[model samples]
Target chain A: MAKSNKPIVWSLFAGGGMIAAFVLPAMIFITGLAVPMGLLLENALAYDRMLALVGNPIGKLVLFGVIFLSLWHAAHRLRMTLHDLGIRSGRVAMLACYGVAGLASIAAAVVLLSI
Target chain B: MGEVMDRRPYVREMPKSWWLGQRRYTFYMVRELTCLFIGAYALVILVGLFRLSQGPVAYGAFVDALQGPFAIAFHLLALVFALFHTVTWFGLTPKAMPLRLGEKTVPGTAIIVAHYAVWFVVSATLLLVARA
Candidate 1:
């Protein structure tokens, strides 16, 4: 309810919406493609031909974006999880929950940018 | 130096709000806990991606790690949690984000049924594609 808690709450809402919108659809897309591609990639990599497929600009961008948003969403949800599990309580606990989520999102963002 | 101290609050009473709030409060807590697996499973996928991005060897190692007694046990646990998370989420979706048109409110059961229908379609499509 307080102003400080607003960003984290809004982030959680946005993250949830993003997961529903992006991650679920993307998952269906990727998994639908994975069966054939996984086999090809697995076999081709043995002969050093598949690296280029995974190393493309568009592929990398999509992969990194999905990973970042999905994980960020997960981090926020997991904080709620800890609270539900009775591991978090009180003001300090609330801060810790959002703090961990923020850090996790930042870490995922860094991973996306770097890789 | 002699002193006796009672750590408990001296008031001999439970707040009135506790009695009024217990049922809803407990239900809310359980609902939140049940929904947690959605996040947990997502984290597992994230870890898999991290490993995959590391390189072929790391990816292979991650795959290999999934094959064993512990992996089997955890996978089952994950499946159970995932199912619980999905069902509860679908159950609550209508309440959380109601779809209304003028005077008509969509039923929660309808939302849940639609969710399962979509999940089944998506899952089957993937399976079919995999076999193809």
Candidate 2:
């Protein structure tokens, strides 16, 4: 029986929007290097083994927090996306979007626990 | 002509609420899905970075897998969505975060324009550096 509210939705939207803003510049830095590095120079940064950095406390914290919150934001937006797409049948859409997001959050938690 | 049954000329206009009907709903869904794709692109990057920080061997495996066709296609699609999302998201930012100076409220359009100006400058600098 939760009430639907625009402000709540927008707040989550804005948070996701902020994450989007942060990611683009970062990707430009990463892929901009990874592409050339992987293709031309054969840099190790192109590989996932560099995930050794995640063992660091700061890295672990950031990764877990980002994964958890971003997924939370994603679930809400995905539900809204379905609704906007003319899936006026609320129950089905909610189950799908929320189900996927819930699984993602659980995986994130496991990753954090292992770290 | 009046005595004839001409049903062709009696068409009615669509209802006003049709703006909120199926077509508009589909458009709205597309817009949000575009953003979701953008979000997915970012997550992949974050996950890659995390894996990289783990170990060189693991990172190498990721790079190898990424070279596959599916990975490349996803990247290209994500790039398109990210660009679209950035444009639309910034267009909404001023509405999300309004700035007031004295009596005047800053407009969303101006804010979006300013963001583009900055994005252009930064991208230009990066290109110049890369070229050098």
Candidate 3:
């Protein structure tokens, strides 16, 4: 068997998938359902509160981890999906898919750091 | 008769709606779509960050806008899609990276339980942090 650099990206993708699965739905539920439906206090997700959370060093890291890894996970999944769907151009797909994820990661880092 | 035969394997043309024909294929399609939903949610978070960068007024407006029906619906949809994605992706763990425990391999159920356990711990920690 030949070793390839894919393990690096694949590890990230796997980790991202785990975190996204673990954390995202509950997040979406709270913001989407609980807050909007009045299940929680009006200011549960208030701007000040959210800003404070994002402004927290730990919170900022968590936010970055969630967004950045999820992007890579989605990107790699989509690339494999394109191949699965019978798109024959492997090199092109890999380049485009990974390229987008990389750019998005940089953007996420910038946004988090600026905050 | 002796003849030289041309050898070309037939490639089946995949149609746009190929996934619609079967239950499993449809499931696969739905799983594939999680990437789109997750990717979109990440973008939404980025937008939230941008609004935050603009200061309280813009951030407040963004938070207020999130209460709208459309935003709620989109979030709900993304949540379901993310759930599906998580389950299916998690189910692949045993196969993706089989773990060995002493002389025996760890069971799939154990792997899943471990993932969920960590998930709960992390979520709980974050919630507590945010609350405090």
| DockQ for all models | 0.21, 0.32, 0.55
lDDT for each residue of candidate 2 in B7-89, tens digit (9 for 90 to 100):
66667865545436688655555567775665465466555654554566765666666667777677767666656666767
Candidate ranking under TM-score, highest first, comes to 3, 2, 1
Give the alpha-carbon lDDT of every model: 0.52, 0.60, 0.82
Binned by DockQ into CAPRI classes (incorrect, acceptable, medium, high), candidate 2 is acceptable
Tell how far residue B43 is off in model 3, in angstroms.
1.1
* Model 1 spans > 4 angstroms off: A1-92, A112-115, B1-30, B34-36, B128-132
Q: Candidates sorted by DockQ, descending order? A: 3, 2, 1
Cα lDDT tens digits, model 3, A53-96, are: 88899989988898888888888889988887878699999999
Rank by lDDT, highest first: 3, 2, 1
DockQ score of candidate 1? 0.21
Model 3, C-alpha of B11: deviation from truth (Å): 6.1
In model 1, the Cα lDDT at residue A59 comes to 52
TM per candidate: 0.60, 0.67, 0.83
Give the Å shift of residue A81 in candidate 3.
1.6
